[model samples]
Structure formats: C-alpha cells, structure tokens
Target: MHAANVPTASPLRTILLCFIVAILEGLDLQAVGVVAPAMAATFQLDSAALGWVFSAGLIGLLPGAVFGGWLADRFGRKKVLIGAVILFGLFSLLTAYSASYEQLLAARLFTGLGMGAALPILIALSSEVASVGLRNMAVSLTYCGVPLGGAIAALIGLFSVSGDWRFVFYVGGVAPLLIAVLLMLWLPDSRAYRDQGLPLRDTSQALMGQGRGFSTLLLWCSCFCTLTILYMLLNWLPTLLIERGVSHLDSSVIQVLFNIGGVLGTLLAGRLMDKGRALMAVVLAYLGMFAALAALGMVEQLQGLYMAGMLAGACAVGGQLILYALAPRIYPAKVRATGVGAAVAVGRLGSMSGPMLAGKLLAAGAGMSGLLLAVSPLVAIAALSAATLLGRDK
Candidate 1:
C-alpha cells in the first residue's frame, strides 16, 4: 500500500491521530454555541451582532480551506495539518483573551482559518490511509471525534463556574496545542498520496472534468444545505431553547445529547456506506433531518425537545459524514485534497450563512419554530442532490 521510496505509518496510527485532532476541531467549532448566552451577556450583544460574530470565524475558513488543501498537496498533509493545528490553537487562546467584541471576532476569524485548513487534510489523510474496503469506516471513526469534542464543550458549559464562557475556549485552545505536539511525533503522511503520485490537475479539471461537472454541483449543493442546518443548530440551539424558557442547564444537556447523537450518526452513516447502502444512508439522514428540524420547533415538553435535538444531531452529522466520505473518491490521489477542500469550502459557506440567517430570522420576528421550519425544505434539496450523487457514483 506504500511506495518503497516513501515513508509510511500504520493505518491504525494515522486514523487515531486524525481522530484526536478531529475531537479538538469539534470542540472549538461548537464551543461558541454552548457559550453564546454567556458571551452575549458579557458583551451586551444582540442576536444580530451575535450572528456576525459567529460568521467571522466562518469567513476565515474559506481561504484557509482553499489554500490549506493546495499546500498539503505540495508539502504533505502531516505538515499542513500540524501547522494548521498550531495556528488554530494560538488563535483560540486569543479568543479567550480578547477584551472587546472586535478583538473577539478577530480572534475567532484567525482560529477558524486554522481550523478550516485542518479538516480537509484530516479527511484526505483518513481516506488515503485506509484500504478501499474500509475507507468509509475509517473516515467515520475519525469524524466521531468531532461530536465527542462537542459533547465535552457542552459539559464545560453546563458546569461553568460563575457563567464564564471563556473557560471552554481555554480548554479548546490548550488541548489542540497539546495534540499538535503529539501529531508531529506520531502522525504519518498519506500512503496513497505518497505511492500514487498522480499529476496535479487544474481546479476546473479536478472538480468538473469530463461529465463530472453536474455531479460536482450536486455534491456541493447537498453539502451546502447539510452544513447550513447543522451549524445553525450548533450555534443557535442553546439560545433557542433558553428563549423558549428552558433552563441553561437543560439546554447544555440537550446540546450534549445532540453531540452524542452526532457521534452515533456519523458511525452509522459510515457503516451503511461501507455496506453498499449509501442510498439508504442518504434517505435516513436528510429525511430524518427535515423531520427533526420541524419537531424541534414544535415540541414543547423537555423530553420531546430532547428527542428532537438528538434526532437533529444524528441526521445532520450523518449527512455531513456522507459528503466527507464521498469527496475523496471523486478525484485522483494527487489532487484529492484540493478537490475535497473546494467541496468543504462550499460547505463552510453554508456554515457561515446558517448562523447569520438565523440571526436575521430572529431579528425579523421569527420564533424558533419559524426559523427551523423555514430551513427544513433545504434538507429536501440536500436529500435529492445526495441521492443523485449515489447513482452517479456507481
């Protein structure tokens, strides 16, 4: 599986390293959401201002993903990933240290730049490292770290002393810096990338060559829609629950349940894909996502809200896993990271817009139910697009 001329590490080690990094990524990505109420209180931020705050980090992700993947293709995934980790770690700490709202936004932007860079490389490395028969499972296992991390962040929020949110950011920042050291010591370069050594392709050729253009568009559409709802909930769920008169502690618990469900859903999505049930995975993920979104708005009881939150997390995360698993297969090895990066960059656009859109909806007098129902149709679009990709992939 590896070239005689290139160094390689065990697939187990590579996947483990990737999983650890993913946990840190997940924690930071979801940290803002869990801490939103406290942070808003600190800065006297209205929902509209908070929306831009959420988007500032997402805006940074775009350039980071585009260029990070391009560099990894040249310098190697390990290096790019390590640098990205360090970059994000430093900036996340800055996020905690910021004395003003403007400083906070700047810190989150730079932190997202680093985080945005790490995700594509993590996906690329996991896909390239595992054997073909186990690729989906490998990627899924690696992705499980993300939700696990989010669960931890929710726990932090739940137990926070004196309503301080910066503490979660501190843990998020420190853990990644520690992990970056471990990655440098143990993580391996992609055996597939090292062995295949295919020539690089132009963006147009890499993503849209031959008759693949339409399918690529479909893939991007599904990814965009999937992330839009996922991040909207991740960033807004707690506030939504609190606004509906749920206690902060209950909101945190619900968020924890959501992440745990995400972990399970990510694993299930991968397993189904590996078993040649990709279509089933698509249907369950998106249709369930649509239903869960509506349920969240309608459910009044705490237990009902818990069920809805868990379902939403599961379906949304599962849908995202489907896209991450599909991206590497659509392009050749050498240009694989770049291709995946482009797809991820588009997804980040959805991620950025989700929070901002929710903010706008709230500003315009939409309740939580109104906001969620409005976005449910996008799940249908995602379902159709992903289903088409499966037929095309075969």
Candidate 2:
C-alpha cells in the first residue's frame, strides 16, 4: 500500500536498492566481531586492545553519519550512497590485506566511515520513496537487510572459507563493489529530492525547533539504549556463551538464530507500524526483550538458551529497526537525513560503549548472567523513551 499523497512510478525498486546497501553495511559491521578470535591471535592483541579495535569502527561512524547526511541533503541521495558504498568497499579490501594490527584498525575505521555514511542516505531514500502511510513499513523492510547481512556473516563465520578470516573480509569487500556498480546503473534518487531543489541549509538545528525538542531528545535516548543492548549482544554474545560452558558451534548457532529472529521481527514490526501501532510495537518488543535477556542469563539448557536468544534478537534488534522507521517521520524532508543522522550518531556512541563495557566487566570477573543483568536497565530506558516520545503519528 502506498501513501496516496506521495506519488512515484515505482517505489519498489528504490526500496530494494536501499535494502541491498543496508545488507552490505551489516556484513561489514558484524565482520569484526565474527572474526575477533582470529584477529586477536594473528595480531597478538589483548582483550583491552581488541576492545579498542571494535570501538575504532564505531568511532569512525560518528562523523560519517553526520557528514554523510549533510552531504545527501546538500548534494543528492543517490550520489552520496554510491560514493559511500565504494568507500566502504575499497576500505574493506584494505582490511583483508592489512598486515599489522594497526593497519587492520585503520582499515576498519575507514570502512566504518563508509558504512555509517551509507545508512542515513538509505534511510532517507526508503522514507522519501514511500507514501506517508507506508513510511515505517518501507524503512523496516529496508533495515531488515541488516539482520539478514549479520546472518550471512555468521554463516560464513561458522563454516570458514579457506579456514582464514581474511577470506571473510574479501567476500565482504568484493560483494559491495559489485553492488555499487548496480546501484550506479539502476538506483533512483528520490523524486521528491530531485523536485524540491531546496537550497542547502543547516537543518540539524530544526530538529530541536518546531516544538520538537523533547521528541528529539527522547528519540536519541531510545536509540542509545536500544543500540547498547543490540551491540553488546552482537559483539560479545558468542564469547559470553562460550564462557558459560556452551560449545563454540552452539554459540554461533545461537547468534545466527538471533539474527534470523531479527529479520522476522523487523518484518512483523513493519506490518504493525503500518496499522498505526509503532509505539506499542516498540514497547512490547523491549518488554519482551527484558524477559528474554533475563531468561537467557539464567537458563542453562541449550534448547532453552536458543529459544531465549531468538526472542531477544527479535525484540532488541527488531525494536532498533522501529526507531529507524520512526526517524524520518520526526522531521521535514529537508532535515530528515540530518535528524536521522543525529539520532544514529548518538546510537553509534552506545554501540561503541556496549562492547567496551562488556569487555571491562568480563575482565573484572563478571559472568555471563551478571553482564546480562547489568544491561537489563537499558531495555527499560528504551521502553520508557518510546512511550514518552512526542509528535508520534498515531
């Protein structure tokens, strides 16, 4: 279903192109976590150093999201997206070829910059191409690519190609390059974007104007809380599970199942949001996640843990997608990218902190259950923010 007011020839193509870009970014985002052990061994890294390696990518994401969004607003969405894809692709290739820990760290940071830049543009495209009523659905569908990408990366990690981690980066690097070429040939810049001819202006400040200051603050808080748990799980779950006496194979299986649940949850949440249930969906997802995380911490049986892991992924990762869907709705088209970018920039800080926080706690002898308990409050904070966010459309 399309929004009647917003007319376009074919929004489906736009949605698909943006979805593919998201998938590639997801692969790169999770690649470091998936191959962490191999990286540590090869580089002779300690846990603290490895934590920085994880943070390095996120650190790069901060500026990338802001600059990329501004660039899209100033230039055009398609051009920025194409450039972002190519940027990440080249850097990912560099990651594969890195000979030292320092080199890998540098490569990952640049790769992250590209990955971060691509996301806001994709979100903007997904929002601009859809009818108003379908905005959330379109965004959710596009963002599903993220969990899908993570699942693919997890699969590749499970059965390593050539038994080397570098091969993983090579696959991550090359696939995006091929996709960039397709994007160049086929992807449409949003019709609204092309038609407006709006002068380049600083729209970031407008997020706080329009009587939307509280809404902006709430959205940022929601993103921060949501991403903290999501990244904590994404980066450290496998290691935590293994530490809890689970087999390595089982841990990887659980992670894959988690991401698969995320894909399903995103799809489900989209339909719910289309029915004017976005806030309710987010609240329920976070509430369910709190339960799942608690259960996962206390449960010892493999079957039970697997089920909880899936539920946790469904709620946590899926809830994050809901925020992405909600973001474009909070601002006018002019500042849409800037607003979303600001929220993402805040979330990236949470993403950066999650792994590092877990690393510090784990190093301090906190067990898996303790770590889960530690982050449980974030779920509540996220739920509260969702319920209280102003200017929510139904």
Candidate 3:
C-alpha cells in the first residue's frame, strides 16, 4: 500500500496525538537549557566552549527543519513526525550517558536535528486537521506545549537539584518515546497532503521558486529577525534580571510569570487570527513588546519589572504564533510544510546568534538599557514587514 494510503484516525485523536508530540518535542528544546549550568560545572567548560555547544544544536536545527518539511511532504506528516520523535528520544537518551563535553554536545546537535523536523510537521498537521474556525486555536494549543515543556523542565530541576543533570535527560528522552508510541497508534496524515499529492520534487521546487528574489529574501530576513529576538529573550531574560540585582529565586518566579503570559497570549492570538486580523494582531503585539522592553529597562521597581516581563513575554512569543498562523496561508498546500520549514530553518540562524550577540554586548560593557534598546528594533522591523504583507490574501 502507498504510504499516504495508511488509514487515517479521527481528527480529535489526531490533534491530541499532535499535542502530545509537541510536549515531547518541547521537553527536548528546554532540556539543554535546564542542564547547561550543571553540565558546565561538571566539565569545567569555559563560556566560549559552552556557547559553541549551545550553538551546535541550533545549527543542526536549521537543516533538520527544512529536511523534515520535505520528508513530511514526500512521505507523510504522520510518518515523518513519528520518525522525528523516535530519533529525538534515542539521542536524548544518549545525551544522558555522555562522559565528555564533546559527546554531550554531539548528542544535543543530533537531538536538535530531530526537534527541528518535529515542529513544522506538527504545525502543518494541526493546521490541516483543524476546522476552519479552529485552525489557529489548534495550532496555538500545539505551540503552547513549548512553554509547558520548559515549565516541566524547571519543575524537574527544582525537585532533582542534587547535581543529577542526567535525570533531566532521562525524563526528556523517555517522555518522547512514550509519545511516539502513541502517535504511531493514533496520529493521521494531513488531508492537505492527500489532496495536493505533494511529492518530494514539488516541495523542493516550491521552496526554491522565489529563490534569490527580493520578496523571498525579505521574508527570510523577517523570519530571522523575529526568531532571534524571541530566542534571545527566552534564553537570557531570567539571567538578565538576576544581573540587575533580582534574586535568583525572584528571577525564576518572574520567568514563570513570563511563561504564563506566553500561554495566554498564544491563545489570544489564535482567536484574533481566526477573526481575520492576523496582521493587526502582530503589529499590536510588536508595539506591546517594544513598550514592555522599554519599561523593563527604565523601571527600577520590582513590581514594574514583573509587569513588563509578563507583557513582553506575551507579546514577543505571541507574535511568533501569529507568524506560524500566517505561514500555511502564505504558501501553496503542495509546498506548505517546506515553506514553513524553510522559514523556521532560516530563523534558527537568528536563534543561534541572539545569545552570542547578547554575550558579546555584555562583554563590551553594554548595560541592560543598551542591550534592550538594541533588540527593540527587530520587533519594529517585523511589525513593518507584517504591515507590508497585509494585503496578500491567504
């Protein structure tokens, strides 16, 4: 039987399965961050070395996302997604067993590769299976798994704080294995895939169609800027607060509030996008992010900072959700996965660079105000791009 001909499951089960896969994928994304301090202490690695290790995983993610998208189009979303989960699970398990920094770094790179592929396929699947009125909501629900996974990692770290970073990986690896098994049993291929008959060659041509053109380059630039700013905050906000005299415990608490805001904003974006105002939502979100960051830099009061953190987190992360909501609409069904995957892949470059840039700025004695100001322009640029692209009907 043709791979695409595999029996499809109910849409409700498919969405649930996709959500589970998202949680599993998110666990892997946050696991490295949760264990980074422990890993550094254990290996006596310098900041530069640790940065390389972190970048390695992000570097792998770029190609992984693109390739995974192609595979989903060529094979089937369910098949590619299952493979991604299994690959990530196995590598995460190996990461726990690494005896040296290099080994752990390599494992993380491979794990990231698996993670890169998993998200686009899941996003495509969720969008495909959702009802017309519920598509954005469903997609947002799946994406919310990312912050949920981070929260889970933080909880695990809190409970297992006896220097056992390995347990963190153990949890990350095992959860995905369980989810993959369930996915194999329940997730179905996207109907868009069946209707489009999207072969591998078609996927490739679609990604390359507007290649080297002004519009394509602009889109890539927009994606890169959006992701860089988003990840930079995700990776460094808590530490930034601590540097500004907030206690570690307070910083962690603030991080929790930030994540909570992200969940609410994501859900709100879904509802707003469904109302046919995705561009407006993105623009408003960017403005909110700018105001929040500015407030964060200027405010010395803890209450003000906490409020700013919540607003910034919600707007910044929610803007990304809007981008994904618009992605499937921007490209044809035949190349939908490839287009989104390619955008995300390019965004990884920004993601990898954000932390490094922040480190360099810090080293150069750029205070919190300067650093925050530097990143604010990115949101403006993204907002303008969204405005310019607003006329294009999805």
Candidate 4:
C-alpha cells in the first residue's frame, strides 16, 4: 500500500474492523482442530491421515500469503482484503457442507489460501495507522481477535450437538460473509498505504533493500521456528489431550482456556513493546513457551493440563504477534505489506510442517513427552533469532 494524505480517519475504526476480521479468520482457522474428533469418526481418519487434513489448509497458506501481499502492494489493501475474505468465506461454507474426505481436504486447502492472504494485510493495516509507540499495542490488540475467535469456536463446539460438528464451521463460514459486508461498508483504505507512492519495488527489494537482509533472514527464521510449534499446538492440542485419556468435553474446555490465554498474552506482549521493553516481551514469550511445552508433556491431571494449555497459548501465539508487529517496521510504507507477507509466508511453512511432523511421529509410536521435549531446541533457536532481530535497528 503506497502512502497518500493519511486519510484523516480515526484509527479506532480501522482497528475495530481489522479486529473483527481477525476474529472470524481465527474461528475458521481453529474450528478444524476443535472438530477433529467428529471428522475422524466420519472419515475414518488415522493420525497420519488427519495430519494431511491439517496440513492441507496450511499448504494453501504459503502461496496465499505471497500472492495476497503482492496483490495488495500492486492494487490496494481494502480491495485485496475483501476479495480474500470472500474467498475464504466461500470455502469455509464448502467445508461445512463437505460430504466426503476429499471434499473436506479441498475445502480446507482453499480456506487456508484465503486466510493466509488476509493475515499479512491485517498485520500491515493495523501497524500502518499507529504511531511508533502505539503500533505494537495496536497490532497486538487487533491480533488478539484470532485467539478470541478460537475461544468462540470452542464454545460453539461445547454446546453443539454430537455428530453435527458442522455447526461450528457453519457459524465460522457465515460470520466472515457478514464481516466482509461490514468491511466493505465502513473499513477505509489504509491511509499510510495511500500516502506512499511509487510501485516499482518488489518483494525481494522490499525485504533485502536498505541493508535489511540479515535482520529479514532472522525474522524469517524466528517466525518459522516459532510458528512451527505454535501451529502444532493450535492444531493438535485437543487430539493430544484425548490421546492421553482426557475426555473430549474436557479437551474442549482446555482448548477454550488455550485461546483465552492467547488473548491475554498477546495483549500483554504488545503493551510491553509499546513501553520500550520489546526484548523483555520476547524473552517472556519464548521462555514461557519452552516451559509450557515441557509441562504439557509431563502433567497428566486435568488441572495440570489446563495450566499448561493456557501457558502454551499465551507464549506461542504471543510470540507470533510480536513478529507481526515488528515486520512492518522493517520496510518503508511502499513495500511494508510485501515484506511482512514474505516473512509470514516463510513462517507458514513451519506451521505446515509442525502438524505433519507430530502426526507422523505419533503414528510411529513416539511418546508425546519425547515429542514435546524435542521441540525445546527449536524454541531456543527461535528465541535467539527473535532477540537478535529485535536488538538490531531497522
């Protein structure tokens, strides 16, 4: 989005509109994992097969992020965002109405494509409107809607009738259509994007120009490693809990706790960054995730699992939110969306791999404890990368 006259619009409206989109996007994203059991029963899906189902949506995200960002830079954020929302909304409906396993996979893949595209724009739009100090907090507040939406998904599942898991998807599907209408009616085109001019810059130039290569690489690395574990937990926590003998209803409650925790953690992180303690926020997020991962594996009781779930949700999702906030500052307004989108696109690869890796290992009979513990090194790597990226001046 190139810059224009900065529109003279209230940032509150943009934040609220972006927040609503994040909520619906999140509901759709997290709905699948919550409904996994029902889909498993209906499709006779084994762990490995289920991994494929999870990855299918994520696979679409990679290209969606790249193209969506590219399109936004070329056209405009509002138009591309509207298109992306409609695409995902339509496919989410398909997911609800899917009658066969293949149909489900196809629907999820396309749904992911739309989601992937919309996310970068959300991050970009949220940041572009705020002052430097407020940008992180603003983005965090907006991004919290994702986990809030996840919590809503859990709630929908909790009250929904058995064998009618499609209800959650139905709600997720329709809400975006309605939100898209709201977006079209009230959401303003990004003023910051409008204020900037010249469309000659491309993704590579946006990311690598102005001596930004190393920091950009670190950002990608951090996002990739962090997102791998983040997504693994997001897509599999319910199933993993059940595998360890927790009841489905209990797992759903835990899922709700996880998402609620995410909302809290993300807000706290953004607040910390706005106060000039970004490095502190980074440390807390990664360390919390490390501890949470270990705890999830060792704790067997419902209370223990619930505690771990909240911790995981906070640290994992909050870590991602930090990256979303930081990515925009790395580039000028001319290519902010492209740079942020590229980083997110790289991170989506990690998201795609995390679920499949867990499923295959679990199918191969690896203990959950070992699997969770094995991720500690990855978390450490991400923490170091993120810290380095933070300390470096953009």
Candidate 5:
C-alpha cells in the first residue's frame, strides 16, 4: 500500500496567520465605533440613521456567518478565508470613499459580511492546526487578536488628526488587502478535511448528528448566555459605574482593566483545557463570574470596583474563548466551520440584545445591584449546560 502524504507545516505558523486575520477583523469592526461621529457629520445623519448604519453591519454578520461557514466547508477553509478577507477589504476601502449615508450603510453591510465570515473560519482553522491536546490553548491565544485589534483602534482614534475618520478605514482596508495576498500564498487547508472528501451535508445534520444534537443545543445556550453577559459589561458597565458615582476617567480605566483580565483568563483557561478538565474549568469560571458580578454590585470603593471589573471580564471574556475552543471538538473537520459558525450566529444575537435588555432594565428602575443580581444566575445556567456535556461523557 502507498503511504498518504501529510502536511508537515507547523500548526503555530497557521495560528499566527489566523491571528493576523482576526486582528484585522477586530480593527475594521472597531473602526466604525470610533468614526461614527465623523460619519454622522459628513452624511448629515440623525441618530436614528446612525443607529441603522450600525445595525446594517451587524445584520449582515448573522447571514454572513451562516453562509461563510457553509462556504468554508464546501470549498475549503483557506479559500473561504482568503475570499472573505478580500471581500471585506474591498468594501472597507469603498467605505473610506463613501459620499452619502446610504452609500456608507451599504458598504458597511457588505464589509460586515466579509468580516463575520472570516471569524468562524479563523477559529476553525486554528483549532484544526493545533496539536491534539493544545487545541484549546491555540484557539484561545489566537482569539486574543480581537481585543488587541480593538486596543489598536482606540489608539488610532486617540492619536489621529481631527476630521480624519477616513484614515482608520484606509488602514483597515489596506492592511487586510495586503494580508489576503499573504493568506493566498501561505495558508493551507485542513489535512483531515482535505483527505476526507466528504460531500456537503444539510446544515442541521452538520450541527445535530452523531449523538451531538443535544450537546449542540447546550453549547448554543451557553454561548448565548455568556455572550449576553459579556456584551452587557462591554457596553454598560462603565455607564453603570458612572451612575454609581465613579468618575469618567476611572470608568474608562476600569474597562481597560477588564480587557486585561480577559486576556489573562484566556491564557489560564487554555491551560486548563489541556489538562482534560475543560468542562470543570468552564463551570468554575462561570461560577467565579457570578461571584465577580456580585462583588461589583456590593463594592463602592474605587479599588474594590477595579478588582471586580477585572474579575468580571476574566470570567465573561475567558468563558467566551473557552466556548470557541470547545466548538471544533463537537464535529468532524468536514463540518467544523459550519458548526462553529452557527453557534457564533446565535451568540451574535445575544450580543445585539444584551445592551438593549440592560438599558430597558435600567429604565424600568433596576438598580445596579438588581441588574447584577439578575445576571449572576444566568452564568450558573451556563455552567449547568457545560455539566450536561460532561454527563454525556460519563
């Protein structure tokens, strides 16, 4: 019998490429937030129009994720990733030259489709390339590019010359365009997927087969709950702190601390996953999140608040990365991207809803304590979901 050829490329090399792609995705997505004021002024847009412009991009992401995953499975991950990078890059460049609000909105929507498509493929690729035991760590490490990209956007927004919102778009567009060329030359398709030659399956079957249907549901639920809490903290925690008498500067600083904690938590969780304790680790992580949220509700001092914010971020963001890490293991490589994509699509819904839900609760006269208390139990539910997966193994 002839021996089959195997790809000898280092998985770390692939992970590095995936990281760069993720960072570009982060920068492009975050650029809109920083430039919204300028976009509103240039297009003579009202708050309502601006809100729709923001929403147009997010709306695109839902379908893009689902479609992108399907494409990645059908065509191959590297091809889909390269195409997505170029798609977003071109539209982002178009965004830099948009002459009207409607034009910008359309461009942003297209750009978001590309951006959203790239994320799951990147996660899938990272998971595939990783050595067996280190897949969780590898995915967690590469996913850090997102926050790192956001931090870069904040820096550009702070330092860029006034009335130059377009500069960030230019950077966002150009960098990814260049990176796409590199991906074309250097990125490789998954060896397992390449060897299998599996035909495309129905999306439902891809996600809910081989005794994984219920586990998929549990993962979806965990993703929704954790993402809801994460986005709530991202959008509302500072506002809540400010309302509770924290200064604006301190509120912002706490947000930074929160991200720092998230990075730390990802690192810690990855190691835990390698130890064959992913389920227990994630459960405890969410339990810790509940405690952190409780502390945020009770703490009044600046020092105490700072500690609580970091811990909250550690649990929320770290837990999210853990979910990403777990997703690839639930399916064969042929359908891995689709599976992750569907989960992410669900999570994005929670992302959109979280801030709105928090706002409504606040408007309805929920105190910070009341809000935090309400959120705390949801993490427990998420933990219990992870436990369900654990039970199946036994």
Candidate 6:
C-alpha cells in the first residue's frame, strides 16, 4: 500500500488530528454567539431579527450537510473537511466587511454551508479510524472540541467586549483557515474508506437513495431530541440568566461553566461508552439533566443558578455525546457516513427550531421557569426513544 493508503499513525495522533478538526468544526458552529450581540447593536436589530440571523446559518446547514456527506463519500473525508473549512473561513472573513444587515445575513448563510459540511465528515473520519471497542471513545473525544471551541469563543467575547465585534469574527474565521491548512498537511485519508473499497458513487447512492432500517429511525429520533435540548439551552442560557436578575458578566460566566461542564461530560461519557454501557450511561445523564434543569428553574440566586447550569450542562450536553457515539453503530459500514449525516441533518432542524420556539415563549412572557420546564419533556421523550430502540435490539 502507498503511505497515504496506510493508517500508520499512533492512535493518539489520530485522536489529536480528529480533535483539531473538531475544534475547527465547532468554532464554525459557535463563532456566531461571540458576535451576535455586537451584530444586533451594530445593525440596530431586535430580538426577532437576531433570531432570524442566527437561524439563517442553521437553515443553510441542512443542505450543506447533505451535500457534504456526498462529497465525503465521493472525494474523501479529508478533502471535504478541508474544502469546508476554507469555504467557511473565507466567508467568515468577508462577514467582517458587510455593509448592511442583508449583507451580514447573506454572509452568515454562506458561512453555514461550510459549517454544515464539517461535522458529519469529522464524525465519519473519527469513527472509521477507531477500533471497534474504542470507537465511541474516539468519537466522544473528537466532539469534546465543541465545548472547548465555545469556551474559547466566550473568552474572546470577554476580551473583545469593548473592541469592535468584527475582530471576533476575524479571529473565528482565520483560525479555522490555519487549521484547514494543517489538516491538509497532517491528516491522512481514512484507512477504513480504502479498505472497504468504497467508491464515491457507491457511497453517494447509499446516502441519497433507499437505504432505511429501524435502527436508522431510532437514531434519527434520538439525535433530534438531543440536539433540540442542547441548542435550546445554549441559545437561551445567558439571556435566561439575565431574566433572573443576573448581571451580563455573571451570565457570561455561567455560560462558560455550562460549556466547561460539556467538556467534562463528553470525556466522562466517552469513558463509559468505551466500557460498553452507552445506553445505560445516556439514561443516567438525561435523568441528571432533568433534575438540574428543574433546579435551575427554581433557583433565584446567581450562585445557585450557576451550579444548576453546570449540572444541566454536564448532563444535557453529555447526552449529546452519547447520541453521537451510538449513531455510528446503528448503520452498516456501507452507509455509515450517510446514516450519520442524515441524522445530523434532521437534528439541525430541531436545533434551528429550538431557539425560535424558546424565544417565542419568552416573548409571550413565559419567564425562565417556563422556558426551562418546556425542554424537560423533550429530554424524557429522547430517553424513552433510546430505551425503546436499544431494548428492541436486545
């Protein structure tokens, strides 16, 4: 085999490469929050308008994800990922120069296309390289970068609070460009892809056409609920804190803690999944998340709310890791990427709807307690879906 054909790196190096790509992918997903308030202020926009701007990227993600899976199956994961990074990065850089709200919206929509392509490919790459026993662990480790990237963006927001928000976008956009270059230099084509003799056409047909199963349905429902709850919290937490009388700075701090909890949760769940108990682990995480959110709704003090946020983040965000880890197992290798990509694409719809629904509730004067309570049932539904699916398998 040629060197490019050989998967010769240490497992640790493979993990690191996946993690870096994940960070880039995550930064693309999250960089919006760091500058959203600034965009609102600069554009003199209202909450509803801001919501649209945020949703636009997610809307764009739907098609981008579908196209990306086809490209990954056709060209290769490394190539698709590099192309995605470059596309998103260049658009992100151009966003800093937008002359009007329409221009900014257009830039974000274009950026979302790039963002959409990154995650599914990364998940496929990470899962393909991993040993069967350690597959979930590898996927979890790669996804840990999502929280890490969000945390980094929060830090940038703190420092750039007084400066032009455009600087934040510049940082978000450019860092990934460098990361893409590194990926091109350091990342290898997935050994699994070559070993399986998967040509582009075969993969594309599998993804775009009639491959369906009970497991695929179960995975899709699980991902939709998981992502809905995750995005709901991420989009609303800071504002929710402010509603409960927390200062902006303190709210930001809680947001950081929420993401920190996500990092810990991903690692913890990864270990559990590696031990072959992914379903049980996810159930426990969801239960914990339920309790945490309930506590958050009742808590009045900043400290109490912050602690609740941490617990919620740990459990809820970690639940998402479980979903991703379990996803790759639900489909055969022939349609793994397509299956995973389809789940993510469906999940994106929930993610996009989450914030808008939450915002509408808030606008109707539902308050933090009601908003938090609203998502609890969704988690329960997700836990039930997982149980039903996994139980049938047994």
- Candidate 6 differs from the real structure by a C-alpha RMSD in angstroms, to one decimal, of 2.5
lDDT of model 3 at residue 289?
Answer: 88
Clashing pairs in 5: none
**Candidate 6 lDDT by residue in tens digits, 1-394:** 3655554666667678778766765665677787887789988999778877887888878888878866776666778888988888888887888888898889889888987888777788888878878887888888898888887777777656547878767876888889887777777877765565655455545544454466567777877888887898888888777877888888888888888888888888888888877677877788988888888789777788778878878887788787777776665565566667777898888898788788888889888888878777888888887777666544
Candidate 4, residues 69-143: lDDT per residue as tens digits?
888887889999999999899999999888888999999999999999999999999998778779999999899
lDDT of 3 by residue, 121-171 (tens): 878888888898888988888787776676666666555555788887887
lDDT, model 5, position 278: 80
Model 2 misplaced regions, further than 4 Å: 1-9, 390-392
Give the residue spans of candidate 4 off by over 4 A.
Answer: 1-8, 40-50, 161-163
Ranking by lDDT: 1, 4, 2, 5, 3, 6
Model 3 lowest lDDT segment of ten: 210-219
Q: For residues 47-162, what per-residue lDDT tens digits would candidate 2 score against the true structure?
A: 88987788788888999998888788777787888999999999999998998888988998999899888898888899888887788789988998999899989988888755
In terms of TM-score, the best-performing candidate is 2
Per-candidate local distance difference test: 0.87, 0.85, 0.79, 0.87, 0.82, 0.78
Compute the lDDT for candidate 4.
Answer: 0.87
How does candidate 6 fare on TM-score? 0.92
Worst 10 residues of 2 by lDDT: 1-10
Each prediction's TM-score versus the true structure: 0.93, 0.94, 0.93, 0.93, 0.91, 0.92
Off by over 4 Å in 6: 1-7, 198-212, 392-394
Candidate 1 residue-wise lDDT, 218-264, digit = tens: 88999899999998998889889999999988888889999999999
Error of 4 at 105 (Å): 2.8
